[model samples]
Structures are given as structure tokens and as C-alpha cells.
Target: MINQLLLRFKLLKDDKTLIIVMTLMALGLTLVFSSSMSGNYRPEVMLVDSDNTSESREFINELKLSRLLRYTETDEANAIKNIETGMSIGGLVIDQGFSDMMRNGKEINLSILRSKDSIELIQLRSDVQTTAFKFMSKFKTADMTVDIIKGEGFKVVEDELFEETYALSTYYWRYRNPFNLNSQVMDAQKDWAYNPMIHYLIGFTLFFSTFTIVFVGSDILKEKQQKTWQRKLVSPVSNTVIISSLLIVTFIVGMLQVGIIVLIGNYFLDINWGMNIGLMLIVFAAFVYAFTAIGLVVAGLAKTIEQLGAIVPIILVSSAMLGGTMWPLEIIQSKILLTLANLMPHKWAMQIISQTSAYGLNVSNFITSVLVLIAMGTVYLLIGLKLSKRHVY
Candidate 1:
């Protein structure tokens, strides 16, 4: 076993294979972080006011106070053009007589254009309706108050009541509205931080790390190509010893790559993998073991390096896609696809990583993921060894 381990290391140390391994790791890390940390999503919108009245200007100003959207003022023609050309995500065209309609208690019409449907546009529309409702509520309250005052046989001036109500509502809105709605930042941390990029990084890291398995498994195909396996089969070294040695070397290499990725993510990208570094490593170790086992199964099934090269990518890529390595499982709306993803070991491993890294969860929170990986590795390794014993090559 020891001789086999040393021999495998010597073979892997060859410049070409070593370069491919290092290059893949470096490329994966770069892409993961670069794509993750690039920028945040902020929806842009154009507000076109055909009225240009004080009421319309005030409405636009109220919208400006929203953190939900970035608003720009533009002419109706330009706003339509922008929405159509996708320069702005959406547009709000406040029609003429907007103020007059509000004063007369008539429904105000608006021409809304959206470049694409999204939650941001939906929220923006809600905000617009909310602002209009609030403004109209002041007028409604003043009218009701005047009616009550006149019913008591006291003379009430309509203009004076409206002005007072508007002023009072504006004052309360700006400074002291006891009943006003507010959103506060909760003291407790969110389960997952709003960083899709970090999820992408971790998911892609797990997905790309499987490539190490494929690369290491290719050693079997290499031995066959060079007729080295024939000599080794007749040697005093037992087949079990040879296979164990290969797995050990591959696991070490795989863990090393995973560690480097974690370190780079921490130091370069400033990602927090959680307080329990040791547990995270354990999860990674189990995942790497399972990934290596998958490679062994692929190697056992393939007859040549060409076959390994062709089929291993299809297998790993499909696993990555189905296993939520390309995106989060939460984003996958299809129940069937999600159920299929659950059957993948990669999905479990990714869940472990996500819980630990993104959610700041303790190791104890997802010991099941670790156990699942171990079980999967055991099953795959058993199948791989059985196929390997056939030795069709």
C-alpha cells in the first residue's frame, strides 16, 4: 500500500497533470469570488409626470424616499423609450389632472410600463398605490370631520378643514405619526445572508472540486494506457492494497484542494465559513470522500482515458446541475427537479456547506448531511470495487 501511494504521487507529480489540477482550482476560485462579490441588485425606474403639478411633484418626492427603488425623472416619450429599450426596469407615467382628480375625489389614472416583470416592479407599484392612498386618506378624513362638525349645528369651512387636515397629515408623516408603519432591522441574524454570490461560490466550489476526483480517477486509465496495471496485477502487492493506496492519495489531494479553496474564500474574498472551522472541514472531508468514490465508479466503468474523459464530465456536470451546484435549491421551483436533486450526494454536501458557511450554523445542526455523505461514499466505493475486480481493461 505504501509503495502504491508513493508511486501514485510520483505519477501525479508529472507537470501536465499537476498543472491541470492547480489551474482548475485557481480558475474555479477566481470565477467564484469574482462573480459572487461583483455587485448588488438595485432596480432602476423612471417616473414621468405629465401633470407637473405640486401634487405630482410631491408624489415623486415621496417615492424618492423609498430605499426599494432608484428613481429618475424623465419626459413621457423618453420614459417609454427607456422602458422599451430596457434602460429602465420600469416607468410610472402620472397623467395630467392628477391633482384635480385627487381634489375632486376621482380615480387618478396612470400609464405604467415595465421592461420586465420582477418583484422590484411589483413592490414599486405597491409603494405608488400606498402613497396615493395615504394622500387621499387625509382628504377623506377632513370631509368626514366637516360633516360631523356640521351635524352638531356648527359652521365648518370646507377649504379650511381640507388645508388643516393636509397640513396635519404631512406633519405627522414627516415627524411624529404614532400609528405609522415602520420596518426595523431585527437584532437576530438572518438564516442566510442576502448574498447570492456566496451561495454561488460555495456551490461552484463543491461542483468544481469534483473535478479532482475525475482527474485522480484518470490515473487508473493512465495505468491501463501505459500497460502498468498488467505488471502491478502480478506483483506481490494485493489489489486491495493498490486500490486503497489510490483512494488515500486521491482523498489527500481532494482535501488539499478544498482547504485551499476555503482559505482563498476566507482571506481574499472575506467570506465567513462559520465559527466551527473543524466541523466545516469534516463536512468537506466527507464530501470529498463521496466525490472521490463517484470518480472511482466512473473509472471502473470506463475502458480507456478517452472514455473516462468523455463520460466523467457528463456525469460531474449533470451532478452539479441537478445537485444545486449551479444555483440554490430554494430557487428551483419544480418539485420533480428538486426531488431528483435530493437523490444526489452533491445536494447533501452542498446543503452541509451552505448551512455551515452561509447560515452560520453549528456543525451539530446538520450532522445528517455528513452521515449521508459517508453512507453514499461507502455505497459508491463498494460498487466501484466490485466493478474494478472485473478488470475488463
Candidate 2:
């Protein structure tokens, strides 16, 4: 086994196609990683302060502090134009009497111009409204308290009632104080910190795996049709040597793809691969071997190159959907769909990768994933080998 493995390695070293694939994979990975990590999702916010008061200034300053809102102060017309032209997602307009309205305990009209409904924009609007309301409540409470102390009996009206209600609402909303235990408990969920990266990685990995498998598998069929297999069989190379060499070629190709993604993610995207890269590498290597073995099985079973080509796309698309590549499984409310996703190898690999990347997951879970991949590869390879032995024609 050792000699066969060495000879296979040497054959892979001489394969120019393997070297080219590795180089291309490295380049692609670097680019994708850089693009994702560049902080493109945070939208630009235009602030139009027509009031130019202390309140407006404070609001603008608050918006500036939020990492989500990339604030740019501009005139109302320009802000509206920016939003309409898609240069900015939304614009905040603080009206002329905003500060005076709050001071006089009157309703203030704040205008928000948005091209369309978006969750980020809604969240920003909610935060701004809450801050404004809190400021107004504090101002009203202080003013009314002074009036009451001065023996102004008429000032002890519903305005005073409003102050108490506002205080209570703020306290409850801010701290969840006097906790309402009756709220229904929900099932535990995976943490969302790794959602974006994990989903993207799974999609890319599955796509690549399927493509490599089909491409390499079809090549085997082509060789068989051209009698190239027979020519190799007549040489000093045994059947084991040929099979091992082919497996090594696939393994090298798979690693190259992974390396491309990692390099892109690390250098350009500025994403941390994980705390323990060695463990990640080990897991990834095992996954590559599993995919290669599966490809070999497909090739061994397939009578023609066209048959392999037809099957690859089905595997890629199916695996991607089942693996939570299209969307995060957390948002999928269907319990059945979530349960079914567990059947996919891609899903399991993604779960392990996400947990290790975002959180400091223990080594045991990573090792388990590696072992599972190895077992899968072993099973596929054994089946392929058994089928190959009966290929007398």
C-alpha cells in the first residue's frame, strides 16, 4: 500500500492538469474571500438636517456612531435624489420644528425617504425614533417636575400622567425588567454569527466538488473508449497503481480548489479561517478524499462519458439545496425540511466548519466530521473497486 501510494503521488506530481487546477483554485479563492470581507453590505445613509438644532446635531452624531449607517450630511433635495438614484438606500430628514416640537411636548414629524422597504432601513428608523422619544420624555419629565414643585396645580394634568407612562414603557422596553416568564419558549437555534460565510462556503464547495467529480469521471470513460486503459494495463503499472494514481490526481485537484478559497478568504476578504487551521486543513483533506472516492465510483459505474456529465449537475444542485447553501437553515421554519438537510454530507461539513470558524468549538466535533468523511470515502472506494473488477469488456 505504501509503495502504491508513493507511485501514485509521483504520477500526480507529473500531471500538468493537476498543477494548473491548483493554481486556478488558489486565485479564485483569494478573490472571493476579499470581495466578501470588504464590508459591502452596510448601506450608505444620507442625513438632511433642515432644523440645524442641537437635537438634529445629536441625531446625526448618533447615526455616525452606528457602524451600519455610513452617514453623509446633505441638503434635503440632494438626499432625496441620492435615495431615488440608488446611490443611498435611505435618507433621514429632521424637520425645521423638530427640537421645538419635542420641547413643547408636541408630536414631531420626521421624514424618511427610502427607495423600497428594507430591514436595515427599518431598524435604523426604529432606533432613531426611539432615541428621539427618550430625549423628549426626559425633557418633559424635568420641566413638569419643576412646575409641580412651584405649586402650579394646573400643570398636574395628563402631561404628568404621560411622563409616568413613558418612564414605565422605557424601563420595560430597555431592560425587560419584571420579566414576563409566560412568553413561550422556542427551540434552541444555531448562532447566526457564522451564517453568511458558512452558507457561501458550502455552496462554493459543493459546486466545485460536483464539477471536479464529473469532469474527472468523464475523463476516465474517455480513456476507456480510446483503449488508453488497456495500454496502461500492459505497462509495468498494476491495476492498483492506475487506480491510486487517478485518486491522487483527484485529491490534488480538490485541495487546490480549497486552497484557492482559503487564500482569498484570508488575504483579500480578511476573514479568519479558524483558530486552529491545522484541524481545518485535516477536515478539508478528508472531505476532498471523500469527494474523490465518490467521483471514482461514478466513473466506475458509468458506461459512457455522457452518463457521468448528466449525473454531476443533479448531485451539485441537490447537495447545495440540502446543505443550506441557498439560505440559512435557521430561517427555514419547516421542521421536515430542516430534518431532511441532515441527510446531506455538505450540510454536516458546513455545520462543523461554521461552528469551528465563528465559535471556539472543541476538537471532538471536528474530529467526528473528519472520521465521517473518511468512512464515506472508504465505502465509496470499496464499491468502485469491486465494480471495476468485473469490467472484462
Candidate 1 to truth, TM: 0.68
lDDT of 2 at 299: 75
Q: Write the per-residue lDDT of candidate 2 for residues 1-393, one digit (tens) a residue.
A: 466566545544444474556445535653575355446556788889889986567556656766656778999889989889989979888889977887777887888888776545765786777667665655566566656655655544655665565566546645774356665424423222443454465456555655664465445556787787777778887888777767776787677667667666656655565545566667778877777877777777777767776876787677667767555565466788888886656666767777776775667888788788788889988987776554424
- Per candidate, the number of residue pairs that clash is 0, 9
lDDT for each residue of candidate 1 in 1-393, tens digit (9 for 90 to 100) = 677888888877653465356546654665755563345545678988999987788778777876667889988888888889988878988899998997778997887787655445666788778877776776567667777888899876877876687678778876887385766545543333534445666676677778876678657767866778767889898888888888898888888777877777667766666545577788889988997888888888888778887887798889889998765676566899989987788798778777666556665657888898899999999998887764544
Candidate 2: RMSD over Cα atoms?
A: 9.3
Instruction: Tell me the alpha-carbon RMSD of every candidate.
Output: 6.3, 9.3
Which pairs clash in model 2? 25-260, 26-260, 29-260, 29-261, 29-264, 30-264, 33-269, 34-268, 34-269
Alpha-carbon error at 168 in model 1, in Å?
8.2
Q: Which predicted model would earn the best TM-score?
A: 1
